[model samples]
Structure formats: C-alpha cells, structure tokens
Target chain A: MAFRVVHYINQFFANVGGEEMAHIAPELREGKVGPGMAFETAWKGEAVIVNTIVCGDSYFAEHEKDAKEQVVAWVKEINPDMFIAGPAFNAGRYGYACANIALEVKTQLGIPVLTGMYEENPGADLKDKILITPTANSAAGMRKAAPTMAKLALKLMKGEVLGASCEEGYMPNGIRVNFFEKERGAKRAVKMLINKINGKAFTTEFPMPNFDRVEPGKAIPDMSKVVLGLATSGGIVSKGNPDHIEASSASHYGEYDIEGWDALTAEGWETAHGGYDPVYANENPNRVMPIDVLRQMEKEGKIGKLHRYFYSTVGNGTAVASSRKFAEEYAQKMLKAGVQACIMTST
Target chain B: MVKEIERVGIPVVHMCTITPISLTVGANRIIPTIAIPYPLGNPALTPEDEYALRYKLVDAAIKAFSVDIDKQTVFEF
Candidate 1:
C-alpha cells in the first residue's frame, strides 16, 4: 500500500489570485490545484494532494501567524502521510511562506513536508530542516526540483532514514548529527585541498561561502559633526588581551583605551584572530587594528571625536545569531553614548 | 556590525580588504583599503605610498558617511 500525501500553496500557485490575492489567507480545497498535480504525478506513492490552501504573498508575509495556523489546521484535517509545498525559486516572500508553512505542518502533524528553494532564498535558513530541496534560481529549475522532491517525499512516506542532504540532492540544513564515522571539517578540508593540489578529483566539504547582505541605511550628513565609533574584526584587544580571542570565530572581545597618543605595540599585544596569518598582526597590531591611522585622523580633524571604546569580534566560524546579537549590543551601547557614526575595519 | 550600528540611526563606514565577504555579509556602506593584513598602511609599500593609500581610503570612509544610495554601494581605492 502507498502512503497518502497532501499539498499546501499560496494564492498565486492556487490560481485563486496573484499579487492581488496575496492578502488572501489560507483556505483549503479537496484536490490538487497548482503544482500539486505535478507533484502528485511525480511521487511513487498513492500520493493524493488532499487539499490546496491558497493565501496571498503580502497576506502571508504580514500575517504569518494566521497563515501558518490555518495551513497547519487544514493539513491536520487531511492527515496525509506526506506534505509538500513550493519549490520556490528566488521569490523571497513566497519561498519563505512555503518554507514556513512546510515547517509548521511538519511540527504540528508530525508529517514530513518536502519543498524546494534556491540557495539565495532566505527561507532556506528558516526551514532547512523541514525537507527543503535546493532548486535552481528560476522557473528553469522546476524540472529538477519537482522530480527530486517527489523521490525524497516518496522515500519519507516509506518511513526511510534519509541520507545526507547533499547526497539526497538537497541543501545542507546546518543540522549536524554525528553518525560516528567521519573526519572533522578541518581534516576533510586539508585532504580535499591536497587532492586538488595534486590534480585529483577530491570533493570540497564547504564549497559555498556564507554571506548575507543587510539592508543598507541612508548615509548621514556632516561627517565632521557626527560622533564616530571604531569597531574591528581584526582581533584588536586590550594590552593584555585576557579573554584570548580565538584565531577564528573569536569567542570574546576586550576593550582598551588611550587617553593619550599611544599606539598598539606587538611587544605588549598578540593576535587572536585565527582566520588569517597571525604573524603579521603579532608583529604589528596596527596591521589589523589600524588604530594608529585612525588616531591620527582624529587629530587631523578628518572626523569627529573617536568613540572612547571600540567593539571587537572574531569572524571565523562565528554563528550568525550570536554574532548578530553581539553587534546589536555593541551598537546599543554606542548609541546610548551619543555616537553618531561608525568606521568598522574587517580583516 | 555596520547594520547594527546603522539600525540605531548612526551612519557606518566599513573599511575592509575582503570586499566580497563584506558584500555577502551585507555591509551597507564600505570603503576598500589596500590589504587585509594591513587595511590602511601596507608594510610592503614605501612609507609615503602606504600613508597616501591609508589617507585616501580613510578619507573615502569618512566621506561615505554623507553619500546616499538606494542600494549597497561598494567603495574602491
């Protein structure tokens, strides 16, 4: 016997509406609507898309709570063995909505929900664990995502233990479970690099570099009138550097001060940033800190008063959540002190 | 770090040698320098050249405080 499956969707996919229907909240139908039929045909099981809940993008984005609960409730009623959502390609809100719905459904119904998304979609970050397949950037990726999702969903329907995400043609969800038989990332990187250097076909463990662009703000007016702050990722530290900032993904930051025109000397300072060659920083702390030049700038009236303290953090291997929190805290502290501008140096 | 700073209404200028990393990490306004190990003054260059480079990049960074853009803008030296 094959397992029954259900599908979820937004208004655009449901054909109920497009951007106009984006505010349309979740409403379930009895049968396949949009891509659900394609999914139904691709799956091996008696995959029945029991319902299609249509909601608008703006609606879902603005009212995630209502949309998520409604979708979850609708899927719960169906009680299908499997669930699926959009292989959202590059559409930020849609991908996010689908991922959110899929994640919520998996949570409430205890059913595996499968979907696909491009690497660029922020949704992947929020719902990677909820059975997300990596799709290409556009509609062109539909063929690849649809079939791959179907195969994976069918396997889940059979109560199978899924393979690694890459092996299964899915994205790495950042959920690392120890299977007890594998080298660490550092070792794997070394081996693979050696192979590549030797002209062998070695695979890279961490191919994609993680980067997330933040929304840029409007630039301020009157640089000379603004209070300037310094923040460094160059592993700048106090004279003693007590916390021992990691050479990479530094664990802690220390604050220092010089009411006078003193410069950082290697004899008293050390490098804690692990991501790069520490010898340079260890030989001359200014290489990473550039404190010498910044101080000179302050004296020359190129900028307003330098903030009394500079925030420090290591970038290598630091988790995004913690790093963000740290930055927020530092900013809050600076703002409370009347700081109006910042010059952050990254190694 | 730049975003967090700007979130509180303070303008930010990110000086970096790793432009791509900064771009990917979402730095809003950036001023590019000579190198990573030495963002401002490169030890390899003549002291005068190093000072010239550092002074110019820093000048751009300070200038970035006033530049307005609709999207992420990268500064090159």
Candidate 2:
C-alpha cells in the first residue's frame, strides 16, 4: 500500500507572505505547498504528501502549546504515515516551530518526523532528536536535502533499519540504532579522514551544526558605591534543591534572599546543577555559593549593599528560550533592587 | 554578569583564578585568584595563608572597579 505523508510548512514557504502574515492561524488543506509538492514529486515510493498545514512563526511562538495541539489534531484527522517539515535554512524561529511540531507529532502520534535546517539554527539544538537533514544556509542546498530527507522518511516509515549516526548525515536522533556495522567508529573516522586527505569530499561522522554566538555586552562603569548581584548554576540550594531542579536536566530556577546572613552552610545547602560534579559543593556550601565571603564584605562596608536576593537556575541543556527569559527577568529584579553590578557564576 | 551589568551602564570587574581556562574564555579585567577549585583560597594552605590570599584577591577585585580598559585586561597578584 502507498504510504501517506504530511508536509508541514510555515507562512512564507506556504506562499502566504512574510512576517506580517505570520499570524495566520493553523488550517488544513489538501496536498502539499511549495517544498511539500517538491517532496511528493521527487519521492521514490508512491508516497503522496496528503496535506500542508501552514502557520506563522510569530503565531506559533506566541501560542506554542496551542499551535502544537492544533497541528497534532489536524495531523490526527489526516492520518499521515509520515510527517516532514522544513528545509528550514537559517530562519531560527521558523526552524524552531517546524522542529517543535515535528517533535510533538513523532512523540505523541508514534510516527516518523523529518525536518531540515542549516548548521547555524538553534532549532538543531532542540530538535537534534528528530531526523534533521544537513542543509546549507540558502535555497542552493534545497535540491540535495529534499531528496535525502524524502528517501530517509520513506525508509523509516517502512520500518527499515536506518544506518549508524556517522554514516547518516542527519543529526543524532538520540534513538540508538543497533547495527552490525562492518567498521566501528574509529575505523570509519580514519577512512573519512583519508578520503579528505586524498582530495575526496568527506563529511563528518557526526555533523554538529554551528550556533550563533551572542555578542557579550560591554563592561559596566566604575562606581565607588555599587551592589554586585550573584548568580550560580553550580546547583547551590538551601538544604535541598527544594525546587526539584532535575539532577541532570534542570529546567526550574530559584532565587533566595540573604539580607542578614554571613554565610550559607551545607547543613542547609545543596547543589542542584546536574552538569557538574556536585561532591565539593555537597560537602561544603561555600565551595559553590561563596555567600560567606560576600557577607564578610557587606559587614566590612566594602560595597554599598547586596541585592537582597540572588537569582539562580540550572544551565544543563536548558532551552535557550527559557534561559533568556530567566536572564531578562533576573536582570529586571536586580534593577528593581537597585543593583548596579552582578557576578553570575555558571558551572 | 560583568558584561550584562556593564550593558546597563554600571561599572563592573571580573575576578578569577589565574588559569588557562579563564584566559581562553576571554574574561575582561580579571583579578588573579589563588587556585582554580577554590579561586580565593587554597585548601592545602594554612588558614592564615588562605585568608591572606582571599584578602589580596578580593581587594584587587574591589580595586578593579576604578580601572578602565577598552578590552580584556588581567590583574597580576
């Protein structure tokens, strides 16, 4: 039987227009949009992209959960055997939206979800778990990626064993594929290196896309009476990470006040950051949150004052969106407290 | 924190142990600390030695507030 496929697209790709039209709500339609049509026409199997549902990046980011649910509900009715979204080049928001929808569908509906992105989009960070195709930053890479993604999608839908992480150009789906490979990782790496040395084109065994580096802000002014705020991801907590910050994948953050105390003790403090070895911090609270030293300075009148509260959150694989939100809010809180300086510590 | 705070137009200074990691990370206006694990103090040293090191580093870090540089600069112990 011919497999049914659904192609997800954004407002721009659906030919709906640009940012102004991004608020276009989720609606279903018969058959594929621009790229979806290309996929259907180019696919090997008798797989037809049954529908293309278009939504804007602004709309999706503004209404993430609703957008996911709506898309899922639509796909449920269409009942696609496989789903594909994007060849989302460097469009961060669009790539994120497609990745989110694809990830949701695969996890909830038990279907294969495939997407593509340039090496620089942060969508790769979140959706590296999905069958994300390796793509160049422009439409130039579209021809190569579409067919590769289509072929892989068809194979996955047919329950064929996909190749190892190194052989496949897609990001590691985090799904372990047990295969009796003729060569192990080291052997394959050497072969690829040799190929490249011989003037033959060779791709990385594990292709990790690049990330856009945010320019660090410039240093603050010099002032005699300024309060410095402290933040740590070393998992310093009061007795317990009472906030239930995941020992490895923490998403929750907590802030506490130390207006009167000279030091934080391990008797009531613990480490919540999962990314680091917590042994030193667990045995002695001062190892991570040096509230004691900061306290001494306060008593000595070295600085004007301490921000009554110190902001904290775990930084281990936490989403960029969440981290930025935390940072913005924390900065605002410090501002409200009249804090002129900050000393955030991350593990 | 120094970078972010500075963005809001407040003066700031960064302090860290003299380590390759700190240098590579491009910290600006660094005040040298005693060690990596405990930047301000050495666990192996006597209490008086540790206190001296912490006081020296902290003093330098505090003093760094008055100094200004266009790019990254490290403070010697």
Top-scoring candidate (TM-score): 2
**What is the per-residue lDDT of model 1 for residues A1-347, given as tens digits with 9 covering 90 to 100?**
65777776777777777676778767777777878767778864456676667777788899989878777777777778888888788888988988888888877888887888897898888655677888898868777778888888888887888777766767777776445437777788888889989999986655765655555666777666567788887777765567777766655565656456355677776667778777767876766666677777777877777778778877778767667777888888888879888888888
Q: Distance (Å) between predicted and true CA of A331, model 1?
A: 10
Score each candidate by Cα lDDT: 0.76, 0.71
Candidate 2 lDDT, A1-347, residue by residue in tens: 77999888888888889988989888788887888866776774479888888888888999999999999999898888998889888898888987889999999998998889987788888655687887888767888888788888888888887896545668766777777768798899999989988999987746543322223334444434677777665557777667787765566668887777677766777777766556655765564556776667777777666778876776567765565566667777777778876654444
lDDT of 2 at A29: 80
**Top candidate, metric DockQ:** 1
For model 1 chain A, where is the 10-residue window of minimal lDDT? A254-263
lDDT of 1 by residue, B1-77 (tens): 67777777777788888787777777888877767767766778776776566667777888887888777789764
Instruction: Provide the lDDT at B20 for model 2.
Output: 48
> Candidate 2: where is the Cα deviation over 4 Å?
A1-142, A164-166, A169-223, A239-248, A262-302, A312-325, A345-347, B1-37
